[model samples]
Target: MRKWGLTLLAVFLTIILTACNQNDSKDEDKKETSEKTSQKKEASQDESGEGFKALKEKELNSQRNKKTTNDSSDNQIIDYTDKQKIAMLLFQPGLDDKFITADDVLKGEYQSKFSDGVKKKHLPKLTVTSLPENTQMDNTPTGTKFYNIQPFPSQYSVNIAMNEHNMIIFGSQSPIPDYNELLHGLDGMAKVYKTKDVIKSEKDNPKLKEVEDKVDMQ
Candidate 1:
């Protein structure tokens, strides 16, 4: 009976040890799997360039705020309500680089050209405004004459393009403040499109002259 009891005790100890070892193996596997998942998640975020996108969004918000002159010196408000037009910063693929620059878009340096891709990529919010009664779409807008009115000299090169809808997309890195400095902004409140009919557009739409004047200066 004593020998039998001893054998049973040994068997019980062996069973407990085996169970503990199995549990430990499972825990190690789970830990390794969790680590790999974390690594993959980090890699995906880096590839998508979410950091730059987030920064660009923040900058846009800052630009869209109502124009104020009394703000702290740290920030220069860019919204110019007198212009009655939207003045906001745009981001290129890289958040650091502005889509438009002030230096590259010298007067007569570039001409208006219709690009469908430009519309989709830069100004997805662009809507088709009616052309003047006599004005028709210049299929080759590249040939159309675009007068460049200098708002001010810029520290960085300007980037600009035109869309099929006749809206001009201009970009500059300089921040034109809305209060006092907005008049000096590189591309302060430039209109996205222009009209051809002086009578049809201007005759019909009273704001045509105002829009054209603003575009000319920008």
Candidate 2:
């Protein structure tokens, strides 16, 4: 009887140990699953936050651009420290025959780039303002926001227009960030073109002459 009792005691001990081991394995699996789920949630939240931040930044840029457009005085500062070259092109009415490449200037390759950011349905015109003066809309006829200089891609133009029967183009080899400054320039140049004093005038600055010389040489 004593031997039988000892055997039963050993069997009971083995059963308890097996049960404990099984329960421990299940607990470990649950803990691991909980940790994995937590990590996934953290990663998801991080991605969502970053997406929101990017969207907000894009909105801010659009709003600031509009504000710059609405207020002519809010001129964009030029980063000339980077050595941006200022250039312009002017086409006179009677003095010169209409530019032979005028069609190319208004359509093809250049016009395609201007439509990049906008949808096909909302094809907005490229904004042009006189640099330094940003007076494109000042003292001009109503209902006209400077002449749409075509095919001359705004990405390349920096400032451009076909105002008062004159083609005025302005740019910097280095991009001007606050294009409104160039808008001011567009306004000033358009104002000057009205007088038809693009060349050989006391008001013609050195840079303006250089641009004129470039087109004449071309």
Candidate 3:
């Protein structure tokens, strides 16, 4: 009877120990699963945030390109050949002055003042001849006299000329941020030609004397 009791007590203790170990293992597995879920949620949030940022950037760029395209189209339709004569004058008055250098002229304050002055003048028969260095005169009207007034100290100057029919288009440039604006301004000043006007002018003023004089000189 005593041996049987001891055997039963040892069996009960062994069963209790095994159950405790299995419970511990289940608890550990639950903890590992929860940790993995939390990490996945964090990674998903990060990816979503990055995607939103990329979308916003793409939208901004699209708007910018659209604006640029519209402006370019408007400039392209401008008529620069309508006028018989056109003149452009650009004066950077203090550009080469002792107190102001080319670098100083590029400042915002100076540019504003210069641009405002040109706009206010609004000369009908003048053109601003301060084109970019890379500008080519291939399409420019014949007999146009482009002068760099202050050729040495400043890159700005005036263009004066008569077109084939003696009609005049005067243009000027201010410190405009957009090149399209300047081109449009020039196009505005050019006069549209009519077939009748050309025929009438030629009939009224024949070039016989002019042709004879040129022939003699040659």
Candidate 4:
């Protein structure tokens, strides 16, 4: 009877130890599963953030391209007669640097002195329309403001195109707060307006004599 009692006690203790070990193993597995779920959630959030950033960038680029296309399309040619051209010379006086120096004008002394030849030649067939003032596109990496002096007198900005070769001269007199902005703005304008036809016109007809001669000095 004593031997049987001892055997039974040993069997009961063994079964209790086995059950405790099994419970510990199950707790560890539950903890591991929770950790894996948390990691997957974080990864999903990161992917979503990156995708949103890419989408915003794409939208901004599309808007910029659309604006450029519309501006180019709107710049069409206009009709002006020889008499109308002569009247355009009156706008030249406004081209004088009222706020800046003679060197401040386009091409500096060269453009300024072109008027002398006009006075001597009695060129009354040309019409000179100054460019209208408007905000130019900024290309510099540094944050800055820029502007150009429009030769014409008007509140609304005007687009000046001379011939079928798509020869156009657009001008805008924008108010700038500082000198750096002016320089940057002028540089940008030169880059945008610079074209093969314009360069050739400047080279062949530096004085714009054809246009100048049409103006009536008297």
On TM-score, the leading prediction is 2
Candidate 1 segments exceeding 4 Å error: 51-218
Error of 4 at 187 (Å): 43
Ranking by lDDT: 2, 4, 3, 1
Give the Å shift of residue 218 in candidate 3.
Answer: 30
- Which of 3 and 4 is ahead in TM-score? 3
- Across 172-204, the per-residue lDDT of candidate 3 in tens digits comes to 443324333333444453222322343334322
Candidate 4 lDDT, tens digit per residue, 1-218? 99999999999999999999999999999999999999888778766888667888889999999998655533411243422322232233233322221222222222222323322122213223343333343332232212222332233232333322322223345533333343343443311222233333343334444334433322
Q: Residue 51 of candidate 2: its Cα lDDT? A: 69
lDDT tens readout by residue for model 2, 1-218: 99999999999999999999999999999999999999998878766888667888999999999887645322221211101111233323331222212222223212233446622222222222333333433343332222223224334433343332333444334443443444456333322243223322323344443332222110
Candidate 1, residues 31-59, lDDT tens digits: the string is 99999999989878766788767878888
lDDT of 4: 0.40
Total clashing residue pairs per candidate? 12, 23, 15, 18
* All candidates in order of TM-score, best leading: 2, 3, 4, 1
Winner by TM-score between candidate 4 and candidate 1: 4
